[model samples]
Target: MASFKDFNLSRKVQDAINDMGFEEPSPIQASCIPLVLEGKEVIGQAQTGTGKTAAFGVPIVERAGTDRRVQALVLTPTRELAIQVAGEFRKIAKHKRVRSLPIYGGQSIVHQIRALQQGVQIVIGTPGRVLDHIRRGTLKLNSVQMVVLDEADEMLDMGFIEDIESILKETPDDRQTLLFSATFPSEVRRLSARYMKKPEHVTVNRGEMTVPLTDQVYYKVLERSKLESLCRIVDSEEVSLGIIFCRTKRGVDELVEALLARGYLVDGLHGDLSQAQRDRVMKRFRTSDIELLVATDVAARGIDVDNVTHVINYDLPQDPESYVHRIGRTGRAGKKGLAISLATPREFKLLKQIERETGAKMEAREVPSLADVAERQAEVWRNRIIEAIQGGSLGHFRAILGNVIDEYDPVDVACAALKIASAGELEKREEEDYNFGDTGAKPGMVRFFINVGRNANISPSDLVRTISEEAGVPGQTIGKIDIFDRFTFVEVEQESAPFVYEALRKSRINGSRVNLEPAKPRARR
Candidate 1:
């Protein structure tokens, strides 16, 4: 429960913590930071997403002098994790003038050697790569003051025991060691006992990590229509905030792109992003500026944001740890949360394994129908109208309603207003018709005129993003758009025109007010 300030860290480390938006220390950090800061050997037992990185990172960065001798070494199991840990060091050590580099395979070892030659205070790398550097004499651990064995269990599981031992022997025996793992199997414990000097044991939420309050479920989806089905579920469930997990970096990218094009506020996290890019994306996600995030498992480590109403597995987890860690993101602090996964028929075996691993049954669900989505939206719209009425600015609309009530039955008028509010979705038929009369439009597209085009310095992307963002329609469905000096003519598909029209009418482009309507032809001219 202690704040970051309670650690009595240097001003630079404190500022860097603030820069990373650490409003407070997490349980792992709270338990481990002080002990690590005291330069004592420590062992931490914590799950992923428990802020373990910063627990060790803050002390390492704070204590690491500006000397360029690689004073700290962190060993991770994968190149992805090495990069991610290095990124966290860069952020935490931002104001401390401590430089860290991630040396891993597949990347240019020559570049890593050059960076190391230039003198970095910290080195984070996979065991294979670190050992390679040591054997090549590119990395010298004589001056390494602290060593971190992150995810020790995973490293041993991957058969890195010999490499880990060789790498550890290269460091000075007096160096402080910090070992962290989700579970301490006998091998991990033995490794710790041999290397660490009377380490203090620190465990958080050891046995009770299951998310009992979370409702676990899965939907059977066709491979081709997975995105469509996900959108339907999103519309029907009305998630306050959600994180969708994909198995690979590419999967995260593709899913994020698809969701954004469908007018969702979304972003992606993967190893492909630079530290700064990842920071920006995460900052936005934390502030709720982006409501939905798509992320790979590694990139989502240490994410402890609250009020995450949903955890969606766009791709199934391959392991028990990944499966449990993903769903545990929601259903925190006694708030009810839901975890859903999309599964093709071939993936049922994987799903059953997850059920057995987590000791929780995943309810099977069918992909929500379009009608179901519409009904959910209408109910949300009615609730919004109720809120507006309670918040009292509704008197302004009362006069407009009064005028309509004079010519029609009050019930009919109210129903008409509700239809308008819902963009006529309630009355949608198999054909899904919208009567955009007398407008100059192609057979399947409606052309609309927009005020302030080139004159307002607007671009087609701006228009597309705005229309799609405001109207909740797919950006890909928008047709051609022509820009003029003072106005623009844009084409939209017939069904989405009304919603797009209404959304734009109340918005602005390039600080200029928007006035949008169906375009008319000048036939006589």
Candidate 2:
């Protein structure tokens, strides 16, 4: 529909939509909202960034009574998304005074308890924390009229299917259930079959293909070196606009802070920001005030900037499908774009798998040097100066500049002027507490190093979990782990170097202390 008016929505919501600059409903919103408002069980197959939140949020806001009894529940895979969906509901229901609460991990349980005690009308949360509330009698779902499983496929991938089933059991049997996923994998349909009541099938095919114009590339680097390398590459490359995708909120915040410190025009976008903050960041990014946008994958969804020159995967995606979506953000509307991923030796295979799936070969590029970054900064200054000269703006500032030139060498004065014009304030922060040798993993990889090799009898999962627990890193981040009879090498974050070195310094793997250290770089085959 052209506008929310056609949907017969409340005047307040309509006004809010107009103010939010949403002139027309997206395909998923158009189809699913109608069914959901009709109190029908619905299954929506669409991408993460395709306005699914608004589709579900609108109906939930319009239908749920203002009784403040938690009439609606939205389940998301990540804590960031939990915060996001709840925020969206809160906004749409603003004029109605709907109370929505987001409950997730890594936050104070006491605070969540207090919020739940206030009797929210809508509750959005991750499955685990939601279950925690349910068990503690903090979240009563008897009044829940609608249950939405946002990013159902991701939850399933995360092995939360059982948790979802348990949560569904707690909801009212006749509740309107809406499940949305990017792709309808068999397991998703299987869950729909079991839980949903003949759900109305609505699929918005993202067309099984990534953008053709995006040039995909990857570099094999140590885990610790990823961020440093990213800074160098972004500084050197002629990227007018870019997005750096990380896996978590901490990553987004840390990277944004780091980029800001390095004198790059960058900002962070994730679930933690208030609506006002999100709007400000997006405004800056869209206006080209910020050159780099660092965000978690979920939060960066539905960002439709057309001039994005590059998409850097600071962290490799959990799957090949996600790789497609992450890179898809760049090459849009027939514009040539670049997609780069920082891969460790183990994750390189995963990159190969993505290439096979996309039927596109990725070029491996050398990391840009510090000298290259300085050259790029100079070039950018040169272009700005030329633009200023071509526009004939020198008349106003010529006298001041001429006096400065008379006091100093013309070349030195000109260079100082360019530095002042082009200099950016980048932010950096102290790195997180990660060990280099905690998992005995090699520096710059997600994998753990093991002492046992063919002779000692060790395997991947053992090392993965060992390091995963010790270093607080995920198994997914662990990269190619090589086992040797005398020693083993694992790839992990470069920042984790000291930790890993110290952790494994006296630790034993496969019943033996191993020599674990950063490995020598190898040429790609």
Candidate 3:
């Protein structure tokens, strides 16, 4: 590992780095910082947590040198990454008087326009939002001397290649271009060939993509039963701090709602959220105020939390690269972490693809049973009791203990006290098995009816997607999506039912208005 000072960065930039407590440069940073400082075009292949932000950010800040105009432009695939990179730029340029602004959607364009008008030296923005400003004549890249594409492969995956090309064409031809991606896919190569001029390539930890300290596992589950299995596993495992990755923004929202209904301390992060909401959610998550963060791939790109104990793939990612990124959220800083995926039989091949691509063996795990949950709860309780006893503060309870022992045998008294102490947890564990109504649904769920079914040419998968998108209820929490001619019945958790109904009540499915309401139970003679 090389020290940050070895790069011979500007004194102010070095001061900022010292303030940030970055003693040593990461592999990517060590390899790329000096090249970037030399104004060389570079292509970096590295994962999210590889400290690439500072690698390019340091050089950009030091070299841009107090330019009031937009001297540097960083393009990111998602608004979250744009904001994150902008924050990093500001931190690295702290000693310097450079102003970096993050321009992305879900924030008022007028706000960004005002910032741009106020003379920002560095601009970090998502491709779409950057192009929007370009079209609006608010962002000018004519003076931009350095451009960076953070997570280049993710931008390619998001169909931002054209937008990137358009944005690049607008920048100064002599500007330095740095492209950083986890994987150098063919698209990335093509992109570099077209835009970059003899870029130096750097690959860090190329052969080892997955973190060694993470315990990777997958559970075989049916599509509809995934929610039940996820809940069971979460309850049994007692995940202290974790992230659940969903494939889409809708999936993220649905999972968040479903988890909330099930009484999990969770929040959602996705493109649909406002910048303020996203910031609030992230702040809470970092502080451990939110135990589980349900997020889409793009939304989670900027998460750098180290205390995350588990990463659950609520929905299997589309590619192996995404799988690596999702699991990389945990097992950070050489700490042991857990990465678990729930895959339907149909999606099992995708899981295999991830294993082959990442060179990681994912152990198969069974869905946690009720007894397993009970055992885990008991173990947790036992640990708490042992810790309390070891603290030697039970003297205050001696009088009560004596009274109980006088009435009953000592063993009986101990057993009674243990039962009383564990009563609430026992009740919660038992409630996990509570089925709702005649639909054989679990507790916290309700069956609902929606018009526009089979005649609308919709399948169960389509219905699940539609409901998830329209109702903001996760597909897993949606139970028994029965499609019939001109009518469909679906079960959603009771806590999310109102949201589902309100969202779908006036929504259209396949060009037909959907009338969604709670299903009326049939009368028995």
Off by over 4 Å in 1: 206-231, 238-310, 314-320, 328-338, 341-370, 377-525
Best by TM-score: 3
Query: Model 2, residue 332: what's the lDDT?
Result: 57
Candidate 3: stretches off by over 4 Å: 135-137, 220-225, 236-238, 248-258, 269-283, 333-336, 364-369, 386-423, 427-525
Clashes of 2: 35
lDDT of 1 by residue, 442-514 (tens): 7778899898889899999999987765665689879999998999989999867766765676568878898
Question: What tens digits encode model 3's per-residue C-alpha lDDT throughout 1-525?
Answer: 568878887899999999988889877888898899888999998877667888899998888766579999999887767877888888998999989999988898989899899899999998999999999999998999999999889888889999999999999899999999988889999999999999999887634457667889988765656788898898888588999998888888788888888778999998788778888999999899999999888778768887899999989999888888888888876678999998765566577778887888889887888778778877888898889889996887987687777878987887677888775555544434323355434566788778878888878887778766654456787776778898988888775565566556667777777777677775558
Cα RMSD (angstroms) for every candidate in the order listed: 19.1, 11.3, 10.6
lDDT of 1: 0.83
Estimate every model's Cα lDDT from 0 to 1. 0.83, 0.76, 0.83
Better of 1 and 3 by TM-score: 3
How accurate locally is residue 215 in candidate 1, as Cα lDDT from 0 to 100? 87
What C-alpha lDDT, on a 0 to 100 scale, does residue 137 get in candidate 1?
95
Of the two candidates 1 and 2, the one with more favorable lDDT, higher being better, is 1
Give lDDT tens digits, candidate 2, residues 468-523.
54443456666676677755667766644444554454555557555555454453
CA lDDT for candidate 3? 0.83
